[model samples]
Target chain A: MIDIKNKIKEYLTKKDTKFNSIFEINKMSGGSSNEIWIIKYLDNNTENKIVFRRHYSRISEKENLYPPLSLSIESEVMAVAYKQKIPVPKIIYNVDKDHELGESFFMEFIDGITLGNKIVENRSVKLLKPNLASQCGEILGKIHSIPYQNIKDLNTSTGIDEMRKYKNIYQDYSLNIPVFNLSFKWLEKNIPPVTNKCLVHGDYRNGNIVVSSSIGIKSILDWELLHLGDRHEDLAWICVNSWRFGKIKLPVGGFGLRNDFYNAYEQSSKKKLNKESLKFWEILGTLKWGIMCLKMYDAYKSGYDRSVDRAAIGRRSSETEIDLLRLIDNEDRYE
Target chain B: MNNPPSKEELITSVIEFIENDIIDELVGQKRFHAHVAKNSLQIILRQLKLEEKNNRFEKNRLKEILKMDKDLNELNKILCQKIDYEEIDINNNDLIDHLFKTTMEKLSIDQPNYSAYLDEKTN
Candidate 1:
């Protein structure tokens, strides 16, 4: 178990939280890019629970895991987003080397299904589907409203910079994929001029959202990719088909219409959205996901995280290729 | 080696074991990984059964489009290079059709149930 419990004790003492002992430590698994565990401890005869996430030792620094961000930065971003009233898991503490734990942190555990299919298909959650689009827009408006100068150490970028960064990663792999190259050609030519740069929740999608039957979007998790970028990146990523969970017709996270989502954003943020830029970002988001799939495949082939799931995910790059083709060619569903 | 238990026979038996026995026995997160493994094996089985036919079809299409003869992998590499350098116009009807057909064939092996694939296939 890597004696994670002992490390937790040290962390509690360092933060002056006054830990009694660990009640239980249960490992959690989802679309996790880190080692996540639910640690229940008793403090002054009272029970408490927190989610502890840390970098796994097996993870290589050399790995082309998406643009790397330190866990401290991730924690800070979470704090900033929470302060801005953006629905997020409240970060409790950032574990540093002084605590003798690897890069890790303590966070409030929000109970809800972040699984896309569960949110789409489950009868309990499906009742809240109609309200989800506007809720997403409202949360995104607040997240983007966080003044850019407040969050420290954020990489500022436009849509073109993102495209080039991802393209460079593709080239570094020395991987020549014709379809992806075609996407690069198209996105390079269509880079929109940036009218606004704000705090972008780089991975705001259906699967990243936490939902309950009564309270929709309890939290938006996974802030490791937080950056300053085109507002449309967050706007278009939710509409990506993979996040829609087989509801191809329902564009906004498989919950509502694009117009409804856009209207909700305008109502909340008072910013007019660019339809052309939105389309460009949708294409770019699809391309980025496709390339990430290829990277996972490479990780498996190179014997790095040799999980069977990674191998299956590698095959899934084709899904993004199809999405790109549909978007780029203006091919409507079933046509 | 000529064997009585063919590749398909071995694959079928293993798949049957996973589907009938293992799936029923497994639960929780392990069950999800089990499903993924089974699906991957099934994809391998399909590739084994279809590679000969698909490769021949793919190579023939490339030959027609590129106006030269080459192996399937080599032809694909060249096509990628052509697309990379803009040597071949991307809007060419043959190129689009070929790319679409290629991606669909891959999804048939990789994820046949993908919604986009189902929609494109039926159309």
Candidate 2:
């Protein structure tokens, strides 16, 4: 095996940094898309430890394993989140050059457990049941509250014609999944004009948020999908049935009530989440998730990562379809 | 009354067998097997359960709105190729509700713990 310790030292030295002679590197678990290593540099003099993340591979090239562009997005989003005052790991260094560190950036590794699959398995998180939804809303509100002008260069804006943009993206992957096509058709037919555009975390849900067992939501992770669009997109995504895991009642990542989530968001943002607007976004959320599930399946079938999680995610397409149905049913009842 | 087993029934039987017999025996990363079995079953069931009805309903609704032939399968095939959802008319809310409800019903059965969750939500 290549001496990762010496390799890291050489790499860091080239970047003009000095740390402990010995580096302790341990691979962090989860994430089908990219390889995460928890590298702790023990300072011999100060006896202190500093951590940095290194990409396992490059984005343009295909790796036998690991996700593409995940590190690049992670590094970029971490920087953006830091600027927005959203709780996230601090970005210390970013190396995208293929010749340098092979992959991408490095950052101050935040200390918290990602509430991804563990949210469904961990019984301990039940204690935070009452406040979890509210906390999620607060964090999301903070994310959406980011100024649009600051990140204009990122091309995050959805533009004036939101419906047209959504239709194009939905159409791109609607072929294999017909139900989503129909849902998109429905959303198009009932185009609720966008009132305001704000910073939207395109993929905000349980899997991305990091929380301490005792401290609640420590930070929100994963901002690759961050863009400027209808603010309600994030809200609808959190409540989407597929994200609820197996716990359907607690719509907010299956941890808290929908009413509570909406109330909390309203309280935090001082903005009303119109039921009509929310319903439309919820349908869009279901369609988005359903298509995403199909994409994972397509990737796997086409000889991409054949991980168990990707397969499981593929099955969730049906769950999102079911949510789409329920949302339509609820809309019918109200109408 | 001797028709062959429907595709839906065959898929359901296969899923049941996997869930009951094959799942436990096929160790080592059984999660993927479970997922494949469940989704394969769902796709087949959805085709059997909703394909005909959705096609007919969507066709009639489209015909009413666009003043075209009520050939839904043809319309749907064309719709599938086209990427825009706004092209479809939404004059008849009732038809939209029916199509939406049917899709949801098909999906609800496929959820891992949907029944228990529904019971809790309803209560």
Best by DockQ: 1
lDDT of 1 by residue, A1-335 (tens): 46777777666766664555666878777333566878887877878788887766466655645545678888887887788778889998778745567777899988888788888776665566457888888888888887668557888878878898788878877765678888888887787867878888889999888998787889998887788888999999999888889988788887767776788888888899987798899989998888788787777888886887877887888899888887888843421
Q: What's model 2's lDDT at A108?
A: 66
Candidate 2 off by > 4 Å? A1-9, A13-35, A40-77, A83-85, A96-99, A120-124, A157-178, A304-315, A331-335, B1-123
The TM-score obtained for chain B of candidate 1 when compared with the true chain B? 0.91
lDDT of 2 by residue, A4-95 (tens): 55666666667655653445666664343455666666555543343545544433333222223345555665677688777877877776
Worst 10 residues of 2 chain B by lDDT: B112-121
Q: How much does each candidate deviate from the true structure in C-alpha RMSD?
A: 2.6, 6.5
Provide the interface RMSD of candidate 1 in angstroms, 1 decimal place.
Answer: 1.1
What local lDDT score does residue A277 receive in model 1, on the 0 to 100 scale?
Answer: 91
**Alpha carbon lDDT of each predicted model:** 0.81, 0.62
| Distance from true location, Cα of A254 in model 1, Å | 2.3
Q: For every model shown, what is its TM-score relative to the native structure?
A: 0.92, 0.69
- Tell me how far the alpha carbon of residue A141 in candidate 2 is from the true structure, in angstroms, after superposition: 1.9
